[model samples]
Target: MPASASASSTTPAAGSTIHLPKTSESEQLLKIRHSMSHVMAMAVQKLFPRAQVTIGPWTETGFYYDFDSPEPFTEADLKAIRKEMIRIINKKLPLERIEVSRAEAEARIRAQNEPYKLEILAGIQEPITLYTLGQEWWDLCAGPHVAHTGELNPQAFELESVAGAYWRGDEHNAQLQRIYGTAWETAEQLAEHKHRREEAKRRDHRRLGTDLDLFSIEDEAGAGLVFWHPRGARMRLLIEDFWRQAHFAAGYELLYTPHVADLALWRTSGHLDFYSESMFGPMAVDERLYQLRPMNCPFHVLTYASRLRSYRELPIRWAELGTVYRYERPGVMHGLMRVRGFTQDDAHVFCLPEQITAEILRILDLTEEILSAFDFRSYEINLSTRPGKSIGEDAVWELATAGLVEALSRKGWAYTIDEGGGAFYGPKIDLKIEDAIGRMWQCSTIQLDFNLPERFQLEYVAADGSRQRPIMIHRAIFGSLERFFGIMTENYAGDFPFWLAPEQVRLLPVTDEVLPFAEQVLSQLSGAGIRASVDHSGDRLGKLIRNGEQMKIPVLAVIGAREAETAAVSLRSRRDGDLGSLPVAALLKAAERANLERGATLELASPGKEHS
Candidate 1:
């Protein structure tokens, strides 16, 4: 998804992209990394005495120390800082924790003339402790650090980068230079970490989105709003088409809802009360306040309430690619991954109480099918039970919770139980997908709601002609197309599978003589529903091939005089190497089969044999 549309399919060796555990997972590594941050600060202060340290803390990967410096740090400064840190680590300085009174802490901070530290000291409660690194440096901290610097592996640490950050993240305060670094338990762990970081940067969707001319976020248009260019829009249409096919095949009816609704609808739905913080301000429309939708569930609910239904039609499955807008605070949005405006692949299922387990199981199966279609084969599932403060009767909560658990058990998906983590209205199941490089991203969620139905007073005719409330379940597979697209782009490193690529094939004519032949081949491919384009730039044959490959086009058809005469094209595939020569008809059949099967590539090597 970055500048490089990598066609490299070779996964890093099993242990090469090994996971560097979170700071909270390993106490020893946590202490080492935390101590490394302090060591880095000490080294920086020793070199640049004018620098005043503020907050230094360990992140999921490593640590960062924010300092108010006279000038911004340069690339050369990182090398100098690393050298100083190594010298300090070699000294094996003993880190001693000293408990001090607030007065004493204030006095020490004042003596050092660090206004940032003094401010931090004032805000913290009593029983302040200071960890002194020998006689050279000391700072206010609540640490569980190693006793000595010798416990750290010098080879395992590296100074990574520096950026400008507001002091305490307040733009009004002095801007501080933040130096980021990562320290691991061993050199191998560090190497794996570096590898992952490098790969992540290469796969960063924000960069590739521009390089591939896919999508963009404009400052003038508004923050967190995406504009899908032609190529991106074409791929989105393909994705949406595939999604509709799957949903219809799975017995789901699509729905189209208004973007703005009466504010009373949100108030009745409890969104105005509970979710107002995320909602946009209401607008007056002919004296009636109308609110931009932040969720599509309320509208779907009203649709059910529009008419009475019988128990015979208990399960009403409706889906929508509903675009919703929510207020995202400035400085928090990142590319398409975190956007204020996004379209959610949302669905809601209303069924009889007894149908809960079977329905949930069906949803899970559907989720797996949809996710695996995009190559997200592995998942981490979590079943969150009712929270301490939640609606619905205890019996209803137990029934819904047990239904989720039973469905997961029947699906044979091992999941972790999160105690009291459900939404105030219902229990929920959260799913995170692991990508090719071992990065995990939370996407899908299936939430069982009992409160909304009760709030809306939704009912259906029972078998005995009595009115009964139907159970409601809310679910989302891709969460948001914007986010899933970003994840997918990064996962494939912008080299989409053959069936998913916007431009599936490019016909490259080696000579002007074969131009007519290229046009004929294009027509055949297009007739078969394969996205194909003929390069008519009049560039050299090699330049055409290079340009096709650069765009990550799946199939590059080399049409020369020889190919034209024979009614064949030499295919150079990005997925599988050179497919020597194929009759235009054979090529059409292979491409069609791949598209029909949603296969990643055409395994032409063994003709009829699939790649498995």
Candidate 2:
């Protein structure tokens, strides 16, 4: 299967000198991965003579081939298969591409009795081709492979795992065995790829979410519906608070739109016709069908069209933390990343035609500011133009596409142009953030839409007193709070920044004698707007410290007889090492300042470190 955004970015690893390019970015890697799959299929067939091969495709990171076998493959089988693949590679077998007619292809497949190959052949168009390995083995594939097997590095490829897959991904079809493997041009690249896979597992958000008590998706509540635990909710509040403040400061007004609306409204917006598959089935309320909104744009559009607006208010920016629901397939529910219900940080700007570039530039500036605060400083940008089956006139598409380009240019950000890759309504700019491990997650989009305004019949009174359709620019910074939270969690590996941590400080009482003092310190910290709590577990000092570290608490304060008597507490910081004894007042001040500044760590040596 092709790797999704959950897979890490193409950026090089943190502090690593080695760079591993994805298969898409490197043509040589593509051929290597493709040929590796054929070699693997040959190996499997050689080792398990009855194994039948189906489709094998190169993924971004690796390749996988589906097979029909009477028995499932085991770890021992994989080892033997690897040995056979090495033998095949060492033989310097030539891979010759042979284009054959329909009859000839069917004859070969019939001779092999490969039913899956016959089905695949019936569906594909001519000129049908096959690739032969040496003189003995051949399979159906239109390949651009290396000249010989010797070109593949025997030490640079590995069979990773085996999983069950249905034919054509249909559950009704007969299930097959899929073998996943990764290949690289060099042994070092293969080593790097393996290291990244391990690191990805280590930083998996789903695992960290449970380990940190952040969130859950219980089967009792059905799939894809998140239950944000207390700690996770608090952090979410902090993020939302910051987002609201940023929007207000950027001169945008917040709107609280309805979660469900009349079904006719969606039909008017074209979602009912085009996006019904993703939407939940409508419910009848008061004899009228109502839909759980799958998008916030249509609601915003209705709000814009509620009343006539003057030219002076042309560039109106309205934002919302709107919760929306969509029908995600059963097997696709992946923690917070893909969910049935999610709160989007949605915003729409209705501007004059002349204001598109300026509004887009402003959005770019705000996007950078908000995402940078979360420590995602590196970005990969794409400017997507109109698709082949898109709405809006050619002139309008050109204007919208040019506006996005001008904004990116004015912001001095380099972006790749994705021709005919935009939404049906308009052109857009997509931003992907590179995490600490170099994996990219898509979180931001700015689309200049001409369809929404036209559909909703939205108009503003111009300076010349004529009603004109205001340009609607739909943008989302976080896209969805749930997905962004997952990305951020993995980005930090659940060790959140001091400002964003649910419990920024924890007070550990060294002894029963220090309980009163610890409570006093906790009061002071909480009074100063710091998220602090006493350990209160009555555990030993060592255990308390260990527990605090295990929870990934940013700062831990230990109160003992000596320290309490001196009106100070010993502190340990996760970001910075052990901070020496500091008075309760100083601790409160530093924490409050860190939260106020949205800082990653508490800097005690700064000018405001000491409290009066």
Candidate 3:
């Protein structure tokens, strides 16, 4: 089993009688959230009449409202607001929508002395609309609200938090207070939401990274730049080693590309013209421009265009863990999850059109195998077909789409067809892996492009003595390695699987008398290719064991006088359980077996496959 995944210890209880429906999947939930925001605004204004409600919108999971208020809100204010909201809910006020002209809406705002509303009325489209909650309040909106406030459950909603926000997200504009809240159809679902939120906080990768001494985002080096510590680097090396081995086994040749490339190369590839917004500003060098690459695809295209190729070498699979940098706005920079500089496990397949189906099938197989290795067995797959406007010929588009569908059907994996969701250049397939917390993160993508080949005029000599453009398929399993590392960190809650643990084993000597034996045992374990270290800090055995547990080491070896005399060591397994003192040879054999098999736990008493 690929590391059985669940939010068991860190999320909502499995038996909780609640179903949190996605906002897109539930119209009622959307309405509830939209109405909840209005209720919160009403509550705030009732308490602070000077507070001006700006915008209140429904989000995927909740709702938020920005208010230009005279005083910042406190936690106590949130509590008071909640009480007032529920009181209004108990009144069962009817919600009514009214359509008016821009002149009338502006007149109403002026009467209410709301300058923000007047400004909003000026910018909105004609056939202006407003929603009224009973006879009390009204605001500009395009609403699909419930008939009455009674439809909302007071117990099912809660004000989450508040923070400062600039009006329209502009720094030059007046800063406003933004209040965030969540609403559901039932209180049970609210409880589940709270549980998940708490769990997410506990498993936050930023916190875990620092606590485990894994990685850091140094203030001096700037935000969004990761500085991997020794322990974190070890795990990254292991991941990369496994990735290379898997790619090689799947017939992918690794490539190394430069971090900066000639700006003309990007222009030739159409990125300079189309993707300049995400790119860093060009630097001038020797009166010419130097561009920091935000993507590796153009470089791969250059390599294919480097030399003439024959038909026999049609399918060339090149993979690279290439690092690229892009400009992320100040507030958007996040720890690993969203970064300015990161490595992408990117690969491109240059194959003949006739070989598209086979190559796609192979890629599907490879994707599943690679993802499953990291314990991601469940995937949400989407096949995006050609859009209204695209680059390739109609016949070629049909052929490429058919190839994708055929490969998916052959692979026997169900997928959702996102009609017209593909890029203008071609069709593609996207895969999102569900983590331990059941949150789906977009990771793998396979796009079949006919434009890059055409733009670069890539060609290969066919048997008929004519040159034909080869199909360009861009794919990435780990879309961004840094993001994936963060996801994996949270997925495992920093308790990495045994095979991937940075510190596999720690040897604890009960006293100074057993130090020599512990060192010998550590050497034996290290010699067997196991990551083992001994505690030499002169701490007591209890402290050593506590430290090892805190570090989440997979195994701990307790070497006492008795064990040292018997040439054995007592083991406590984090994944498995306490194993009685085993002979040095037995311990070594089990450690080697676990390391080789990539098993979840030690092979303790028996030699068969083991599970934690």
Q: Give TM per candidate.
A: 0.92, 0.96, 0.94
Question: Which stretches in model 2 have alpha-carbon errors above 4 Å?
Answer: 1-8, 606-612
**How well is each residue in 1-612 modelled by candidate 2, as lDDT tens digits?**
111232346566877777888888889988888998999999999888899999999998889999999989999999999999999999999999999999999999999999999999999899999999999899999887899999999989999999989889877788899999999888988888888889888889899899889899999988899999999999999999999999999999999989999999999989988899899999999999999999999888888888899999879999999999999877667889999999999999999888999999999999989998999877888888889998888887778788888988888887888999999888999888888889888899998888888888889889999988888999999999999999999899899999999889999887888898888888888888899999999998799999999899999888888778888888889988787788777777788888889988887853322211
**Model 2 clash pairs?**
8-439, 9-439, 9-440
RMSD of each: 4.6, 3.4, 3.2
What is the lDDT of every predicted structure here? 0.88, 0.89, 0.87
What tens-digit string does per-residue lDDT give for candidate 1 at 1-612? 101111122235245655567786689989999899999999999989999999999987799999999977999999999999998899999999999998888888888899999889888887889899979999899998999999989999999999878887866778889999999999988887788778889899999899888999999998999999988888899889899888998889999999999999999999998899899999999999999999999999999999999999979999999999999867668898999999999999999988999999998888888888899877778889989898888988888899999998898887889999999889999988877787778899999898889899999999999999899999999999999999999999999998888889999898788899899999999999999999999899789988988888899988888889889888889988787778888899889998888889886635422211
List of clashing residue pairs for candidate 3: none
lDDT of 3: 0.87
Cα deviation of 141 in candidate 3 (Å)?
1.8
lDDT per residue as tens, model 3, 295-396: 999889889889999989979999999999997867667789998899999999999888999999999898888888788887778899989988989989
Candidate 1 local accuracy as lDDT? 0.88
Best of the candidates, TM-score? 2
On the 0 to 100 scale, the lDDT of residue 50 in model 3 is: 94
Off by over 4 Å in 1: 1-19, 110-128, 166-175, 463-468, 605-612
